[model samples]
Target: MIIAAYNAQDTLVRAVNSALGQQVPVEVLIIDDASSDDTPRVAEGLTRLHDNVRLIVSAENGGPSVARNRGLAEAQGEWIAILDADDAFLPGRLQRMTGVARRHEADLVADNLLFFDWQAQAVAGRALRLADDHVQQVGAADFVGQCMTGRSPFDYGQLKPIFRRRFLHARGLRYPPHLRHGEDFAFVLDWLLAGARFMLMGEGLYLFTQRIGSISSDSSGQSRTILNLQAMRDHTLGLLARPRIRADRALAGLLSKRADAIRDQAIWNRAYPHLRARRPGALLMEMLRDRRSWPMLARHLVRRHRARMLAR
Candidate 1:
């Protein structure tokens, strides 16, 4: 299991302990990304206490993508599991997911996540309420469509999946080191486009805590997030442009949806940067850059007008 840490001293121990206490033989690689907090010292102590735990510290903070890529390079395990320093895996997570993957011959497997509140010290609920069925194999086109066309800015693309090391190595799949916020989305998209056998279990085996500084919840990082998503769209276009990809009608449709979603995001960001903006030129440029954006922006304006009428 690879845990990326950056100023995560408060909850790092719990996260590492969860992985260490799993049912399977686990090797913990904790990469401290130049955290100013006591994360380095805490990680060192963990390494000394347990031989399975290895602590590697970066001299400079290079964000989660770089940290995860570093861990991937050093990993010796047959399967790679990603555990955020602020989150945790439930008991039997590794054993259960591995069994499911092997049974379905899946290259990647992910389960639902349960949200926990840090300050309240309570569990909120499951992030995704799946069907009563046991497990389901998700098609690449369907998964990509759900991720790309959703109204949510980032959609549900941040899911952490356990991947077969051989599959990753064969495809040369690694997190884009340039992306800091939307790297997971891009990574998963790559796997989908590469025709990975992806499985989703109905059970929620990962505990995702609602924390202020987490990458997903940080409001201050919205601009960077938007830019990363734009890059993701560009990458998607490049992939879809390939002859093999263009031959797949379903995949091509998914990619088009992704492009449309990114165009909408561009207009939304320009209109409401941190909830308020006075950038007409930026909005105009966005509309001009993408032909689809004109209709999307017009629809947005209609919604706003209706909302104002209701308020009055």
Candidate 2:
């Protein structure tokens, strides 16, 4: 298991322990992304406490993508499991996910996630619904469609799956370092676009904690997230433009829809600064061009009106 941590001192120990506690034999690799907090010290302490744990402190901060790629290069395991420093694996996560991969003959597999809302102190039983007790193979078109429409609980941005190292190495796949946020979404989409035999099980094996101060929580962070998503959408569209990807008409169409969905979101984000400057007319026009954008714009307007009323 590989964990990329940045300023996660409070949760780092628990995350490391969870990885170590897996039912299957596991080695933990903690990559500290030049954190200014006590994360490096905690990681170093973990290395001393367990022989299977190794800590690598990055000299410069390169974000999660760079840190994860660094861990991928040094990983010795056949299957790679990623654990965010703030998130953890439930018991038997490794054993069950690996077993499902072997049984289904799948190259990559992910299960449902359990969400723990730290601020709200609430928890969701499962992130996705189980179709059945059986493992289901996810098609490229279906995966892309779900991601584009939000019709399904499965999200490449959040679902942390176990990957086949050999398959990844064969494809020369690694997280795109240029993306500051939403890197996981692009990585998974890349695999799907490359025709990876992806599998999904209904079991919730990973606990995803949603807390304040995390990368995706605030306004500035969310702006970056949307922008990164836009970049990935553009990247996918570029690939779809090629004859190779375009040959698959079904997949090409799905990719186009996904790209359009992301473009709408990018437009929404771009309108934020203008909206702040009381330039609502242009923003309204942008939202009107895309039907999907109307709902988002309405919500924003509703929230602003509520705040103003409360202030009054």
Candidate 3:
């Protein structure tokens, strides 16, 4: 298991313990990304306590992608699993996921997530509904289509996958370091495109923690988020331009739509400050500058209005 940690002193132990508590024997590699807090100290403690746990500290802070890539490079496991610093695995998660992987001959496997609200200290809900206890094969087109912006509250990209290490090493697969956000989606998209036999299980074994100031929820980092979205948009376009992607008509169409959606999101992020400040003139100017964002803005307004109406 590879965990990329940054300033995760408060929750690192819980996450590491969960991995160690698994029924099967597992090696945990914690990559500390130059944490400003005592995360490295905590990770060091874990390393000392558990012989199977190792700590790899980076000299500089390069975000999760860089840390995860470093862990991937040093990982010796046949199957590689990613665990977030603040999140954890439920009991038997690895054993069950690996079982499904071996039974289906899958290169990558992901299970449904159990959303945990940190503040509430309770389970919020399940990420996906498991209609039946069966594994589903995820096609490249289907995966890309589900990732469309505003398609759902839960993103398919959020699924943390356990991958066959040999398959990744053979294809030289690694997270895109340029993207602080959406890197998982990009990596998984690339994996699927590379002919990975991706399988999704209905079991919710991963605990996905929802923290108020987390990267995805924090609005103060809007500019950084916009840059990430732009990078993702460019990445999608690059994929669409590939001969293999273009040959798959369904996948190509979805990729094109995803690119447009990402562009719209970046534009919306740019305009959000004006909207929040209640500066109609500034918001109008921003909208006029990027007329392509109008459809997305309209959809947003409609959704808000419907939500308000339903509240009544």
Q: In TM-score terms, which candidate is top?
A: 3
lDDT of each: 0.75, 0.75, 0.82
- For model 1, residues 1-312, the per-residue Cα lDDT tens digits are 899898888788999999988999988999999988799999999999999999888999888889999899888888999998878888999999999999999999988877655654555556565853469887767677667532532255767899898999999999988777667877887887788999988788888765322222233211112245567677667778788678998888877877778767666655444333556776667656656556556655564454334323
- Clashing residue pairs found in predicted model 1: none
Q: What order do candidates take by lDDT, descending?
A: 3, 1, 2
Write the residue-wise lDDT of candidate 3 on 1-312 in tens digits.
Answer: 999988888889999999998998899999988888899999999899999999999999898889899999999999999998888899999999999999999999999987665655555567676853768999888798788875444569889999999999999999998778888898998898889999999988998885332222223211112137777778888887889987888888988898888877887888867876789999999989988767767776775454334323
Backbone clashes, each candidate: 0, 0, 0
Residue 90 miss distance in model 3 (angstroms): 0.9
- Which segments of candidate 2 are over 4 A away from where they belong? 149-154, 211-227, 267-292, 297-312
lDDT of 2 by residue, 211-258 (tens): 321222222111112236656676767767777667889878877877
Q: Which pairs, if any, clash in model 3?
A: none
Q: Evaluated with lDDT, which candidate comes out highest?
A: 3
Q: Between the candidate structures 1 and 2, which one is better when assessed by TM-score?
A: 2
Question: What C-alpha lDDT does candidate 2 achieve relative to the native structure?
Answer: 0.75
